[model samples]
Target: MSDAPSAPHLSRRVWIMIGAAAAIVTLSMGIRQAFGLFLAPLALDMGIDRQTFGLVVAIQNLLFGLAQPFVGALADRRGAGTIAVAGALIYALGLVVAGLASNALGLGLGLGVLTGAAMSGAAFVVVLGAVGKVVPAHKRTLAFGLVTAGGSLGQFLIVPLAQGLIDAFDWRVTLFVLAALVALVIPLALGVAGKPPAANHTDGPALKPALAEAFAHPSFWMLNFGFFVCGFQLAFVGFHLPAYLRDGGLSPSVGATALALIGLFNIAGSWLWGAWGSKRSKKGLLALLYALRGLSMIVFILVPLSPASALVFAAVSGFLWLGTLPLTNGLVAQIYGLRHLSALAGIVFLSHQVGAFLGAWLAGLTFDATGSYMLMWIVSIALALTAAVANLPIKEAPLVRSALPAE
Candidate 1:
């Protein structure tokens, strides 16, 4: 189902599809970001320590990463709309399984594997892939940022509500309620239910050649390496921040508020960053973003813990959070072209998820072993700086076909 060459205008249909994609992302990503708020209650109810819970959470992210490329390809071959709808159903099923489960193993099966795979089909990458296909190259990142911001908006809107629900009913019931809420993404997905635009003559060769070319390129590898840090910082912070704040003698409300602030600020940051990236060097911006994360972590750990500090940290961190996504994804499309954008983006995204797995798992193991999160925080800071350095070498230009040797 190649897209029609109809002079590429943002018509009513395009905006409608964009709105639908954004709505779906709002719930999928928002709920994922809210997982940290459940750690204490889930662990308490299940009689598990942070390490065990962390391992399962880590597994969830790991599975999500592993599944995404394949899922993205499926979305590419089939229609993103169908894949997204299927993902929503699976997401609901996964949540239901998690809610009904009483033990760690059962919860792991639900939350770690089922939910993770569901997210592969339903979450950020899938929606971004769809959004990329519809919008023209010039406006792609801006549109991607809109969907990215939708996820942030979801975090801002849902985390507080989830926290209140958890407070009122309990974790299990809250999850069930969320399951129902996620179902709404299904109808919205209908608007995105079609194929990518047809490949123009300038779009290069088919999938295998494009992939081989991407893999052979040094810039792609560099992109993958830097993206790992994004995953690590985000997953570690998202999953552990609430617990960290609680351990510092803050109330639950404070932790919840901090998370909400992150969501709130990211809504603005994602849009502004992508809008700015349209003109500036994306790689430079990425390096700066990573460096800021390191500095922010240092400041966060050095400063005494309090509501003000937590809120301020959330504001700063949130501004930098998830903003990398549109830039990175857009960069891939810029270098590789949109024909294989979904598959290539999925491959790069896997790096982030790998870091996510390590971040969550290691944070938990370190906490249980030493009863402190300091080691993980230090590791995060070092990785942030390293990623900043790594992004410096990326070349953002499109691949030069004539220069390549015969495949």
Candidate 2:
């Protein structure tokens, strides 16, 4: 052959959609991750104890998780744009309320329920679902990686930015500023709405039958259980690590840096998982990652506490942090197909959030009672190891196609 046919090129519209998705993800996650930087400051400002603050965050995680399925459903039915816009507005309001909060109720309503619900609408599930529709199947993993990495970049960039704001002005001002920033997500989300993509099989089997099929799969249960542990470990550390570092006599800057490091390194970690998932068995990689998380936690606990050590722990642990997200989400797409992925992924995510509730709440309860986080640390490691073992047995395969109606 004299010349091979030239490859087709993606239009400007597709690139614009990709950019919008990335921007939405970055803004949403940046605001969500910035909440950790405010935990202690907000608590102290409101004259509440750490446990009280932890409980609010715990509720947020719970509600966030609980709201996912419903939100995903809405997005699937109404389109992702409407859901994203509503979430952005609610998120903005949540920040505003948190800025003026003077009691636990305000915090709970503003930071917990409102923000949680908003996050449900604006989370990775929705963002990645949109990406799945736009990107080619062969390049989907890379697209997913870019979106996940954008969230990590948000965390990396926003934590320090929020901290700097807090330092330069006040926490209240920082909250208001962040609220203003969150409002920007509304426009970005608009790009994701409209017709479902060719790759997206939105009118597939009924939701009930799909759920039934997933429930019958042994690997699905394994993946669900494994995901629960991921939630437990990550939420526990994310919500409480700042407070724990403070307790250990570290400065607020150290805590912020730790969170930033986790975000920074997680950018690499998520990309690594995306690349690896494209090449290897995702389940096996998941198991190895969980094992590494457990090992990292063990080493962190064993070492004497110090800012240097905390940073080191953050850098190492960060690599294993949200790395689980891309793999877990990819597994859902691979196993269930994209037809009902938002709903199925949302359900699995609910379990993860339940674990998050436990992790965040229990850390506070145990710490309040014993004045030590050592036990929580141990539990996290144990859960990670258990997840590693659990994931080892999961079998990943495509779902059996059914002639059932769309739910």
Model 2, position 275: C-alpha lDDT score: 65
**Candidate 2: tens digits of C-alpha lDDT, residues 90-166:** 99999899889888898889988899889888778777776665666555665676678778888888889999999
Best by TM-score: 1
Residue 190: error of model 2 in Å? 2.9
For candidate 2, give the lDDT of residue 80: 77
TM-score of 2: 0.93
For model 1, residues 65-99, the per-residue Cα lDDT tens digits are 99999998787677688888999999999889989
What residue runs in model 1 are displaced by over 4 Å at the alpha carbon?
1-9, 403-407
Residue 50 of model 2 has an lDDT of 66
CA deviation > 4 Å runs, candidate 2:
1-12, 198-204, 402-407
Candidate 2: C-alpha lDDT: 0.81
Give per-model TM-scores: 0.95, 0.93
